[model samples]
Target: MLNRYNPHAMHQGYYRYPTISGDTVAFVCEDDLWTVPVEGGIARRLTTSLSMVITPRYSPDGQWLAFVARDEGHPEVYVMPAEGGEPRRLTYQGAERVEVVGWTPDGDEVIYNSTAGRPPREVVLWRVSLEGGLPTQYPYGLANHISFGPNGAILLGRHTGDPARWKRYRGGTAGVFWIDRTGSGEFTRFQPTDGDLTAPMWIGERIYFVSDHEGIANIYSCLPDGADLQRHTHHEEYYVRYPSTDGKRIVYHAGADLYVLDLATGENRLIPVELRSPRTQAQRKFVETDKYLQEYTLHPQGHSLLLTVRGKPFTMGNWEGAVLQYGEPQGVRYRLSRFLNDGTRIITVSDASGEPCLELHTPDGVTRFEAFDIGHPYRLEVCPTADRIALSNHRFELHLFDIEQRTLQLVERSEYGMIEGFAWSPCGRWLAYSFAPNERTHIIKIYDTETGAIHPITQPEFRDVLPAWDPDGEMLYFISLRDYDPVPDNLQFEMAFPMGMRVMAVVLRKDIPNPLLPPPRPFEETK
Candidate 1:
């Protein structure tokens, strides 16, 4: 029996998504991505400053690397010079919705699924050139994770035209199949096993897939001709993810740690390094530099957490920390008023006046402590230190307010587009803001308070938004959508990915306040 509420202690040894190649293996744990040598050496840190980086695929030539980065500005595919240079964005044409599923044999193009068209969306396969050219859509429909076999045929996660299967397929119980690049071939189902099959890896004539038929995810291998069934391992607790093979060993992530399985002997081995628990060890030492984990949780103190989750216009509201269902029929819109460090007084941007204004309130009375006639403070943001509040104004400029001094400081004066989200670094030294237009296309920018310099974190093409800072402020997580076509005839929203939500973490100067602010002050008796 456990006596303490230590969330970190219980989750110390879990690693995730391991990939092996010769002597090198890579995986992500607690949002940090790492790689190590297979000959029993220390693991090296790949990326720790971002909230989440997943679906990492090494180029066939082994000279380039690609992965999906869910940065605050967009969820797009990024490629770094294999030896390690700043990552270059590949797709910038769609919404904040896309996925990188397969790499072409030539290593010159990436195959991915995107939702570029309509609702009840279709996941269409699209290819982006590594050499930088316009993306071309494959004619197939309802497909995912496309892998080009040696013969140039594509292996895909089967898409059922019937709506019944769509509703029941969440725990990854989808069928794998083959299809041509053009929409002419019939959808032939691959495996009908009781377990859900996903992330299909094809090597020679043997088809390998990850399934959870025995109640735990594990790797299973079968011949493409549908013969010879083999169960590789007996490990029942850890989840087997992203099974990939170069016609040799099957590699994947076991509990965020990298692992490789020998096809000849059917044995498994763990990578030398383990990912630190996201709940504890906000930072950990790797072979050289330290890797950090990004965690997103509500600022437990209140006010700072607003839920615009349920609404008509969907304006913001304050998270008062307590669930009070009374008078105005509070909708999901919320904003950070004041924290306990100052008092229980909450501030919010509401449609009280003709134009939107900042309003302050307390539990005791409905009297207003402060009000500002700001236009459309859509994304209300507050800095925990220095008593500052910020909001996106009508002209697409970010307006900062000094709550105590009653002065406004223009932190970011931008006319680029509407601001989507903003977060302060843990140490309050910098601010990260994501912006896009009402129609969906934008940029995520990072500003240094000390140097007054602005760094654009994303490429100009993809629409990225929703930046959430990791607990340690080392990474920021946002959504990215790509593969856009502006032709009205081609614009059908047919590319909507089934996996819509992605989490990213950006490295920040430091970690911010959790259970934010000090405790609330005791109520004074009014005589």
Candidate 2:
């Protein structure tokens, strides 16, 4: 049985899209609808459907709850009693992507936004009747989050970019605007700023919204005419998102806790919400190792396969041997493990030292070394002679590290794009990598460590990648997209593939004979 829940003691799970009525707040927790008191108390589950439900909005009268649910494979608008009961489907033509905006002033219809017959960057607002009927689209062109104002005026917050993907963005599409629904279809910039603004809530004569103008996102308020701007919350750590108002108080999520700001007193307090549902996912359970496998690589000598599963490095025999696990400390992540030249040590990028650093695991012990000063190391390749290591970091800058000398060299800074698929020559004298010169194609380049000179191996017109050094160091092998063999498609009246890929070998020296050419017959000295 589940234990008695206490709101002040519980602090787990993600809560989103909160809408407050008189004193009760409806929100989504772990893809399920739930309700909790505004003064902080235990939450009661409202819906138990297996499908995901989100974006719950309360009716103006506070008797009905409207939300978007994917119970029937596609997201549709559903309305149920605010106190919890059977939900009635209102929109049959709901698309896979839909959001519950708010209810009409009369509470007879629930307004929502859908991507049906519209581009991904734009969504049209549609209002569906609570009695179940077709939804009517608003005359708006491109609006994501909207709030109704006096005289049929709409405070439109155009798509301000995805909050989950980008942060602190001040691009072109970053601020909110206003549009008049009953008049000409024209949008005017409201509260113009370089920061990203979203979640506009029109309460009385003031408009409340969240913006990252002062670094971190915080609650700010301005008049309907876009004057007398004031910042309500002074949050500088995490962004305040998904704010809702009941005309008296503003409730928003900051980090993992929900906070409510009293408009009159400007007092912000945490709304401790305790979940009484079963902790099925938090409970300890054995997980199958096979399904959690992330990466695998063959050993240099083909003796065993190195695998990284759930951020733990392990080695399993290719034919026969007991599995060996090289587990690190808690909260540390290890990636891209490769065998060293001695075959007794493994080099990998690990965050064991609180930051991403190069680590060498040997039979004796593990050794840590800082690889970069700015960005974390991503992919690395150990030289054949074990003298140098070529690696690229999160900043897309390639670097060469000398192990014995404990020195680092800036190989090259890729201005156009990321440098990828790099390999060290057999003699460890040069490094070959690929980078895109323009937006259309990639070219191969070689960097000589001894001379500190760089040279281009392939032209920028063709794309080349996956470079490998021929064991003798006389030729370099790479894959290029030069084959233009097109295959006609039967289903569509067009060519399926206009170009393919083929492996090409380049002789480093001009005196070296072409490997693809037939070998000349052995002749006597007379010739």
Candidate 3:
């Protein structure tokens, strides 16, 4: 029950990998992905991915299972069959999305990193061909944490020049190169007498890397000819991520959890894991659902609310700065708005010309009000008789603005394929939505503001849809995924899902009126 916006506090063990039968050692507890026996006791599961499989690795003859799935849409690179089915994609199209960072000792080939169209802040290594087609550019220069070495040699996190301006001689630099898989030049470079080294592991002649130099970042080893540079573990404020290995212990990520280290008794364990779950969080606090609320809006007497968030230095200003601020206090990206029909004002999204509109506040100031250019708009609704303002669009569409005739209207278009939540009924004329398509199905449908036609209802099972309608509009309250993914006698995520399958609720029309029937109240206010 510890979910004050949940920030870690629920982890068991397992996590650590290296099997392909080097005697066995793979771990990822609960939703499947295990493999112990490196001389220990029981532990076996090895393959599963319905919604989240991650960084698995194994294929130097362990048959095949080179991971990275994220359900689909961004993180790609699959191979499956280490006893699973239908997986094989191995990096496709790309334009800023294709992770699968390393594997090549005769696993046929695999090494990835992307930004598909080339520049979204650099990160471009590619070298596919596991008996398939396309993918072969490992030129070196704009790199990022790739790794290969059992003997094929190739390790990354590079950047020699032209990163729009480069800058770094002592403020946390990052170098660790050594190429030759066909992107030749014998590259060689490792200079980090201290600080700036990330995700580098090879283990044998040494090359364990992950450093903030000595001010934090920990786990270091080096010797790809850079010679004896040891410094293996002295944490300091926890930050390491991705430093893996299977040649007998070494795995990383220290605050997004997951940790291990035993390259011969320097012990460090904490494999009670999480691995990578901070898409964004800092002094965090979150909760929103006017159908996934984001751009803010809702007044005309439905109580109050107009939040925006990203204020007070929420960060951004070091692309070597020259007037490149994105969001935060000074940029005014904060929109903790509130309204219940003109008793006040408050609405914000900010950053107008660079797109992300709407602004209108009132402690007596801020009044830019334009609306939707989209960069993350999420569920906002206001329609009291079509005075309009509907929103939700990270490309699932929906739109519909008119805020007193300013003009706009896309009106709806998700097609049961990736629109996570939406609602509008209280007499504003029928809307209710929620979808997903394949994390085990999550439908919901229902549109029709005067016959634009939709109507789906129930027929979605397997958790997480989220909609909530009926303050007098027939009924709809969502969340589903009842049970499936709880195998953690010790952490696991080889292909995640099953760490407790959350999000549940269902009732198509028991006479409507269960807006989540009382079960969430108490955010501290007990006088």
Tell me the spans in candidate 2 whose CA falls farther than 4 Å from its real position.
1-9, 94-96, 161-164, 181-187, 286-291, 371-374, 436-441, 481-502, 517-527
* TM, every model: 0.48, 0.88, 0.27
How high is the lDDT of residue 131 in model 2?
95
Please identify model 3 stretches exceeding 4 Å from their true place. Answer: 1-208, 211-216, 222-235, 238-333, 336-338, 342-419, 427-438, 445-456, 461-527
Lowest lDDT 10-residue stretch of candidate 1: 288-297
Q: Compared with the true structure, what per-residue lDDT tens digits does model 3 show for residues 1-527?
A: 11122324542343432333355555444334655554444445555556555556666666676766655566667777765566777666645455566666656887766777765767777777776688788666678666655546765666421111222233433454554433444765656454555567666767777656456566777676667787767766655555556667766545444555677877765543233322232335566534443344444554443343334212112233232212344544543343423535444455545667765555566666554464467656654445555667677776665656676667656554557777677777776767665555767776776766777776756545667774655556666656665453544434444454454444556764555568677999799
* Every candidate's CA RMSD: 21.2, 4.7, 23.1
Q: Model-by-model lDDT, in order? A: 0.60, 0.80, 0.57
Cα lDDT tens digits for candidate 1, 230-280: 777555556676666655787776554456777766667654553333454
Tens-place lDDT digits, model 2, residues 160-203: 43453468776676656675544355667776445788888888
User: For model 2, what is the alpha-carbon lDDT of residue 514?
Assistant: 84
Q: Which of candidates 1 and 2 is the stronger one according to TM-score?
A: 2
Q: Is candidate 2 or 3 superior in lDDT?
A: 2
